[model samples]
Target chain A: MRRSIVNDPDDLVAEALEGLVLSHPTMLELDAEHRYISRKQKARDKVGLVSGGGSGHEPLHSGFVGTGMLDVAVSGAVFASPTALQVLAGTKAADAGRGVVQIVKNYTGDVLNFRIAGEISGDDAIDTEIVLVDDDLASDTGEDDGPGRRGTAATVIVEKICGAAAENGMDLQQVAAVGRTVAQRSRTMSLALAAGTHPGDDEPQFTLDADEVEFGVGIHGERAQRRIPFTGADELIEQLVDPLLEELELGRGTEVLAIVNGLGSAYPLELSLAARALHRRLDTDGITVGRSLVGSYVTSLDMHGVSITLMPLEDELRELWDAPVRTPALTW
Target chain B: MRRSIVNDPDDLVAEALEGLVLSHPTMLELDAEHRYISRKQKARDKVGLVSGGGSGHEPLHSGFVGTGMLDVAVSGAVFASPTALQVLAGTKAADAGRGVVQIVKNYTGDVLNFRIAGEISGDDAIDTEIVLVDDDLASDTGEDDGPGRRGTAATVIVEKICGAAAENGMDLQQVAAVGRTVAQRSRTMSLALAAGTHPGDDEPQFTLDADEVEFGVGIHGERAQRRIPFTGADELIEQLVDPLLEELELGRGTEVLAIVNGLGSAYPLELSLAARALHRRLDTDGITVGRSLVGSYVTSLDMHGVSITLMPLEDELRELWDAPVRTPALTW
Candidate 1:
């Protein structure tokens, strides 16, 4: 087997949390029993921001727990939802009498558990609002019965805006409202050149031929519905960006914040090329990229892919995004 | 051929720089002509910091240009040193009359070019000091005649410490001294599971069997001195740590700042596990980790590997490290 640097696959998440907390001792504290990471010094009398999901997306829910960001983040096994009990504890830990806003990605298990936790937290007089992020344009079937578009990299924007709003002492409703606005306005598209292997498994979840790439892939290692010819950087990034521009209904002179996100193993060089292509494409269409982030924030194990997230930047969203943040993954 | 999302390898570095500068317009400004990135707003009357190397190790010289870090960063092709003229241009760009401290990794080409540039910059009345970083324990041959250990991960610590010292109004000499001390005290060890393929190359630089790993590897995609049985995370980490402890001559109660760096394709889960193993091993050694960083700060071009950097933290060094830094790749 292509060995992973792990003891047992079961112990990976817990040990990782241990290391994360150890590395950021002053900024974070972990409750290993409940599988949640919370800020070391809890903020008081402010709306609490909480987010989480499967464990493989490192620096997402967990790395976001700090000042001016997530107050608590619950995690589960790789690509699996956190248990309702875990989410409940996380939600409770997030409350400090000002209510908690739950920012959850659009995934069935995550949705169910987060909703259950929000409902259960009500018994403690802790009000919670669920801001569901459904930004993945690739999964946008527009069908009412199906699971809606899966959330992708836009979760970073939602978390950042909500965290800033909460840190600004906005009430629960205001924080949740802004977060939902970000979620509603954002759209993302992803493509994978290579699938990631499970920790102990020898084979990748899927394989692509030398001349083809899996387009419209999600973060869970699932294959996309279609394959496209593998081509140059500009062409590939164009494929990802065209759909986002259309889905967002972006018009000429529109301004947006862009995120060129690296899916697990998309290194800095690849991400840089993708970012350049995206900016050039948008500029040609008379759209302005007002703000941007390029990195591997939201990931899917070692999947060699990238996703572009775009959200039309309103004045308030721009200011909120500009607000100071102090988190492991994103600090400024 | 293995498909890379690149249009032409010849234009890759320049385009990536364009993308990087575009993404961080407020913090960075690029001189496309000379191929160096400098701070958007120059800091005056303070010792300037300039560094650069090959292009593949992203977020190195380029991403570190900002308020409290590098003032200028030059670039070259992937895994190739920037030319003397590029270094000269970068040095001139960094000067704001307080002199410049050039942090050069200990590679033949990098060393030769940086020195030539530093010497030539004297004509422009820009005094420069070279803080040579050579911390790779794997390449340590214990002979004075050899080129010395190749600098790897410790360059980050050196750059960070020197930047803080310079920001604190230390003169060029003082900044260089502090930075050199960090480089002197620090040691790094790296290992690769799989070699990285270049952008347009079909094959990797090398390959390892499923049950073997290249121990004592460097940032370049070169083979290690020995191959060892592929083992679990704790054991592999133990192997890396053993040599460091011996080389550093650590005692039971000493404190150190550790950096668990990913060399390209090592993902967060793998890095987290490596960090956990390092902390546990150090704890068993009765050594207190004073401060630590865990991420892909220094990397090969998508090489699947990890490197550990250890430096005994002095009170002065600790304070400098704790100083605020604002750069794209590193900020606190």
Candidate 2:
């Protein structure tokens, strides 16, 4: 039996949003009819920013709907993309005369739905630009092959930088360009020690042996490219960091923003140790980390693993990232 | 076979601290020799607040060492109390010529160690006051009974409020008094859907059947007062809230600051739903929720459960709770 505390799996997304709005009444407003969350104080005449995909990744898109990040977020049921109608509602709610930017992670359903929403918004005379985030190095099969890289934790980086740019009154094209730039500069790779069980399902979406770890696992519990025998933190960090460094083409003295994100159930102690190893390895490689964030920013429901995202920082992106943000999740 | 990502269980705490100092270089300084984390910018001539218990409860003590919360945090091994010498180091590090206040959880080990540190600080000519937090209603006995109550998530409340008071330049006695008051006004009850495994241990500290939940479980994974068949969120909230209301002697028009905290592995989706149910129930009882925080403020390592902490808000306490705070885990 699945021992989830949910009242009903069907109502989980709506109820969670209700709780979010209740806790942050002054900062957020719920569009109950259309099923989206918008900033209580909408930015005026600025290019609106919005992003959402699935529900279980709490604080990712929804916790980010506030002053310095997304203006609206349309949440779907767990690990599933929201309907195009819901995304369209989000775009309309966030638009303030200026065009809106739709940040879509590189997932089949999400990409299709967000594109449809953009088309619908265009018909309604709301200029909507879709910025695709494809930063997962694990899913990389060259720019021409497959669906490109799956967007992972790097979406946080893209949203934050683009949100700051838009808030600074950048036009829709400029904000979208900023989002794409960061997404291009960023890369992420994750490993899963244990798979997460989906709601209403007793079995995990995937299973791993006690001594095995799935490297390059997707956020939705998709199988990694390879399963490797479990070693330890040092080995794991090396496995994650090497590919990220190669993908970013980073080397000595390169300034980077590093994120060590937990995939939900990984404890802080483990995440911290992973961070320590990652930092030491980076230092050994002569990289200068300009900024670092370590936490469960983007999660894969209660999956026990971690993902490391590295974004080589240019002066502009760094400045945008340093700009003040006051969201429920990323406040600095 | 244990499947932790850590390199070594013995060095886990220190490695974690190294990671924390690296992530928040401007805000924190780790004293490796003394095993305590001190604020980089010390609050001069103001009562300094110091707190710690065990290491597994991330963002509890160490994560709160910053501008508006703890001045120093002494971490022990996971789920073990720090030594008196370690606590004394924290006291010395936090003192800025005014005085220091030690916030201690109600566990016997923590109480004894903090008390010893206080006495030692007094001998060193540093005025130190120890504020004992005993707020777990599940472990409550008569006022004079053994240990009063076990401290749980309410420790977060006492520390935040008292830290604000101390940061506002309250005297040592005043800050200590504020801590005690909040502890008195607060009550917490936790239920464990599953027990957390200690580092290096193949088995969890305790266990419950899939359909069973242990109510009133301690943060250290101590068995609860009783085991009951697993119900849904509504029943769990009721079971927790009714006792809390009775213990608080609260009714219509009473105000409270409710914290629906996750104990490690509980997903945010569950936590938010729990918060929603909790708020609706509080409304049905005609209670005015003055403020609310719903997240994993305190945790038992990888335990899949939630703890609800209710702190009745008086005017002074509410003001203190609302004050600005910037820490690794909390910023507002």
Candidate 3:
């Protein structure tokens, strides 16, 4: 329960910025009217990578903004979307002679904010492209004339590959195209064994049975489709893999990038074991795993359980993934 | 509460071996007779890097025994030491025509077993050298005979650097020398906000009051020097930093590597924040941090807390750290 902080919530952002600077002084943190982090001024002719969502996912947006990844990360309050102005500030900070590509997860507010920001930052010289990531199939697809459920974890994988594509000197349009392709080709399913309590909240955001686990849960602890009895890990992984494979059309001979991400409180051993099991199931389906990453890449605070993300990799996507890129979250 | 087992203590090791191979078919698990994983009999003339310790710290002794880091890792059961026979088996599995360098953490049983294994393996036409890591500053270093206290989290950093060095074509003796120097320069201190619980055990290995925490704790939940009131993270980090700096004799312009390692259960956000705090303290002391890694490199089951390791790095250690290596735990 002990935390390092100044007095109130208003100062939370500034205090946290100070801590980040203290921890990673070499990594640039711009403490200006509109805060953003960058290693250097935006590069001309190189595609600009921008990503933003909520602030609670530390080292997610901001920590990931660096040389081979995001040029700027616009951070909002805990689980809250940044205002359009904040997004615009980040875009402006990251904009060089080349255009900027915004990697926005498909949260309703996030989409709206980034879209408005893009319009506001429109310039003849500065083109802006927003790639919406809605890889979570558990979110209602909204039958017709509606966007899919808000994007969650897969945004990270898309950003990583897109960042690499951009770093390899791809133009903004090309980078955005790669980003969209990666997002469309990826699918994620998460389960929650416990809810995460807000920093100041005494009680958990929600409740769950000690023995029951909610599958396909949201990053914000939203109610899942169903709470099922706790069973063996292999069964849980099988349930996750089945939905993901079906969604991504993965079968024998399909090359995949398997991700077994921890939702915070799950043990590493459990996550690795679940990843191992998930890989086996994918193998049984004759799916060829080109690259596999097993860790807590995108986490939901300290919630217990795990998520499986299957990225059916094409040749272009696999090459983009293998490119040398540096980010705090996805370091290879 | 759910676990798989064969119900015989003696059979536990064999069952675990089969489970490991079955769990990870992608990984070439060494068989029972020769527990070594290799690409083929004639893999390469690469300087073989090996690391081993107690088994409870999963993904450490096995997960990291792939391409880049350690060629082989001998795993002991739970927190117990791996037998010399197992070490010899792993050595044989990793012998790719070049010499083998053994990385032994400063635990008594592990050091003893690895030393005996090296002696035995050397007799079989393989040139082998052993590097003993005695980096835990909290241990009873006053004893001149050798390193006392458990070699907790710092072992991961040593393994990474040495593995990187080996990957850079360093001979077995050279890798061992670099590892030894790094170990002497490194010091670590850990804290536990909650005690670790062994699987199937009713209670934790130990206990802590609601407002108390164990400072300078061993990774295995062994008793620490003292139990004190739970102070805020800054004060606690200050306590850890002072001891580490004093022990390492860090001065202005001294380059050091910082490792803020989670002992399992601590969330990634918390670890990131702690790393930020530790970095700030080091900056104030005018120390230059060469490389900083924050993750659960070596864990003690589900212990909830973190350990900080500071290694005063010179040019050689820094060069070795940057050497390109591939392993499951570290890839850069």
Best by DockQ: 1
Off by over 4 Å in 3: A1-33, A123-125, A144-147, A200-203, B1-47, B66-68, B96-98, B144-147, B164-172, B199-204
What are the models' TM-scores?
0.98, 0.98, 0.89
Which segments of model 2 are wrong by more than 4 Å?
A143-145, B143-145
lDDT per model, in order? 0.91, 0.88, 0.72
Please identify which of the two predictions, 2 or 3, would achieve the higher DockQ against the true structure.
2
Better of 2 and 3 by lDDT: 2
RMSD of 1: 1.1
- Per-residue lDDT of B45-76 in model 2, one digit per residue for the tens? 78988899889999788988888889999999
Regions of model 1 farther than 4 Å from truth: none
CAPRI tier of model 3: acceptable
Worst 10 residues of 3 chain B by lDDT: B1-10
RMSD each, Å:
1.1, 1.2, 3.7
TM-score: model 1 vs. ground truth: 0.98
